[model samples]
Target: MSASVPRLLVVGGNGFLGSAICRLAVGKGWDVSSMSSSGKPYATPAGHTPAWAPRVKWHAASAFSPDSYSTLIGESTAVVHTLGILLEDVGYKQSVKSGDVFGLVKSFASSLSGGDGNPLKSEEERKRGYEGMNKDSALTVLDTLISTTPPTSTQTRPFVYISAADAFRPVVPRRYIETKRQAEIEIMRKCDEHPEAGVRPTFIRPGLMYHPHIRPLTTLPAFLVDLSAKLSTASGLPNPFASKSPLHGALESLRTYPLHVDHVAAAVLKCIEEGRGGVVEVPEMRDWAGLGSKKKAEVGLQGQ
Candidate 1:
């Protein structure tokens, strides 16, 4: 795995988490490229790329269309799929903004009932749904990797999927986490079927990743999560994350453990360097970043 200088292809590299991974990858002196719908980081100045963007190749491409990135996959030794959705539609945020308890209850009911995601670039919906965005999009990358890499290749290149913990099970649509799991399962299945393929799977299941400077709104909630972690250590509870807590139904976001996005990016880099494969959880990520139980910083927050 460490035989050659690593070349990384980050799918959705311009998004909130994607950019962080790309930044860390670039910092490692790795040859990095990012494929985002916009072809560049968000909020780029007119006719000017960000300073960090120069070292990286940014492709404005669609996740469903492999043609947009097949050539890149052939050149890349590793790939990271960061594209996914958390809700089928405007679920909890809308209800919370209006303080509509009835609406909130109705949203929960609709989530329980389950529904389809937005269509892929459906001119009507103009967005991809869970099936397309979460599962199929990663498959698109896997299929492209299989097609582009040679069967005689001996080295293993890691494919990292940015997945979610089941923290939103209480409030969000069930399909949100389900699609994530399916993506991981299917990616592994494909690699198993094609043992000679260049891709190896690593799934990152982070819960409520917060960037205080980049996403100020998540600052307060992240502080709460860290405090809970400190409490869990002192109290000797099995875990402090409210993923299974009864009150999760009321305040899911705050109660869930919050991992910092920077730590997550660092962990991804470590996983690839160590040639590690398998599903990695939130606490493990902090440990991988050498943060362990005392993860605290008054830092600030987003995309590649």
Candidate 2:
């Protein structure tokens, strides 16, 4: 008989969203393995591992180096690309260019210790950094899958890209949004180029997501955001969280924006379980999580 458990590889398994995916996938009976350059979950300074660390097979691999993960990609039933950075500094980007795969990640993660910051000063620099780390790295993962997975394999392998709702928000930098747009374009380009390859490409555009205990810092802010959203409706004013809003995009996120991190994880798992390909917007993601859909809109839900 055919194997019942699906083999899944999460490229950023130890990260916030990735770890959630790993845990949720495990609960769904998927044989899940996580890949990261560190080859382990992030631990406290005291060296205490995360509680979910033992549930996954951790593999050391860098998204920049496709060779390091070709074997794992070939053997997986589905692969999720959850790797990307929100900040980029010239010095750190230079270090990453010199084969320091973890340098950019380390610096980016450090910046998040406080709040969001953009170090790429110029549009040119932002474009280059976003394309390299976000767009190119994702394409590398797809390249590895295309080269490693045999065409004869009958299993329907879905490639899930963890894109963001901010990609469409006007408050976000245009370069950042365009970078993610480019990545989605590349995924579709590859699908069109290899129609018979059987590699399904899916893009999950999630809104701001926060975990209660996992990221306690955002819990209160999420609460306030949610409150502000409700007040906006009561006041009969324009929705602050609307994508078309030139301002208050970040502010509106408090009420109508942030989703639970587990919701994103569950949405991804559902996408894989059903072998569905296309864009899954925030509302559908929340629906898949059984949180009940707050909105009925779907941005770009396509099918093969």
Candidate 3:
């Protein structure tokens, strides 16, 4: 990596994934500014208050409110948006909406129909709905980022969106896949609109992320996926693991390819440095495996 660090702004920086990216960028000597809603207290994962926090200029803004994010984008070389929702709960609603009425309605309907409420058989249908809601969020943020900060002639400011790879496949739930795809579309549109500004939008899809400290219960899904894949391979059935019962199965191909959060952050940094703008799908476990193997081989060669 080059020592010439760029100024970067990370939206939702105090959150789990956002914080990871912030730490990596700071380590790389990049001038990083992290923004979160006002009164939203933030602490580093290590339990230490960020030294830069006092000087880094934290902004109080909501992802849904472009006006709130306007001032934060000034003179930034790159912006990363990592806002998302997993399940519809109270906290999730606060992050994405004011209430979970819509989510509750869908969940109740799905339960009544025994998971067959949606007539759309394909995963695309489900994804469409998911994207419908999330696109608004992406657009709102993009609109502010672009309008407030115009890039200089020499600067090619890139916008990075943290998405999921499920959109590429038909196996994942339509809601999850569709929302990510929609967000990607909005990102592309923003990039297209500001070609002169050199605003390049990149999408990063990470599968089944789990940190070393991630709770055991959180890994249950992945464990079941590994088991199913093994069983399917042994059963001599083509895709014996065809079912989407395990979240890990969707990302099993990446088991040996695990990528740490830091690695993903580094990749984002690389993209900014090289001005390489495109979709980068990173499966946590699988990317890490590949990296580890490569390192081991390099070490062995050095021993020789």
Q: How many residue pairs clash in each candidate?
A: 6, 4, 20
Model 2 lDDT vs. the true structure? 0.71
State, as a TM-score between 0 and 1, how close model 1 is to the true structure: 0.78
Arrange candidates, best lDDT first.
Answer: 1, 2, 3
Model 3 lDDT tens row, 226-246: 455456545654434543545
lDDT of 1 at 179: 83
Model 2 agreement with the true structure over 233-284: per-residue lDDT tens digits: 5676545355555554454444355678888888888888887789988767
Tell me the tens digit of each residue's lDDT in model 1 across 1-304: 6566798989988767888888888888899999988896643313345567778888888877888878888888888999886655545545543445677677667656654443344643433567777888889888988777652468887889998877665566666777888888888899899887767899998888777656555677678777765665666444444555655533434434688889888888888999889998877887777776644443553221
Give candidate 1 misplaced runs (Cα > 4 Å): 42-49, 90-127, 150-152, 238-256, 293-304
Q: What lDDT score belongs to each candidate, Candidate 1 first?
A: 0.75, 0.71, 0.60
Model 1, CA-based lDDT: 0.75
Please report the TM-score between candidate 2 and the true structure: 0.76
Candidate 1 residue-wise lDDT at 257: 65
Q: Give the TM-score of candidate 3.
A: 0.67
Q: Any runs in candidate 2 off by more than 4 Å, and if so which?
A: 1-3, 42-47, 89-128, 167-172, 232-256, 294-304
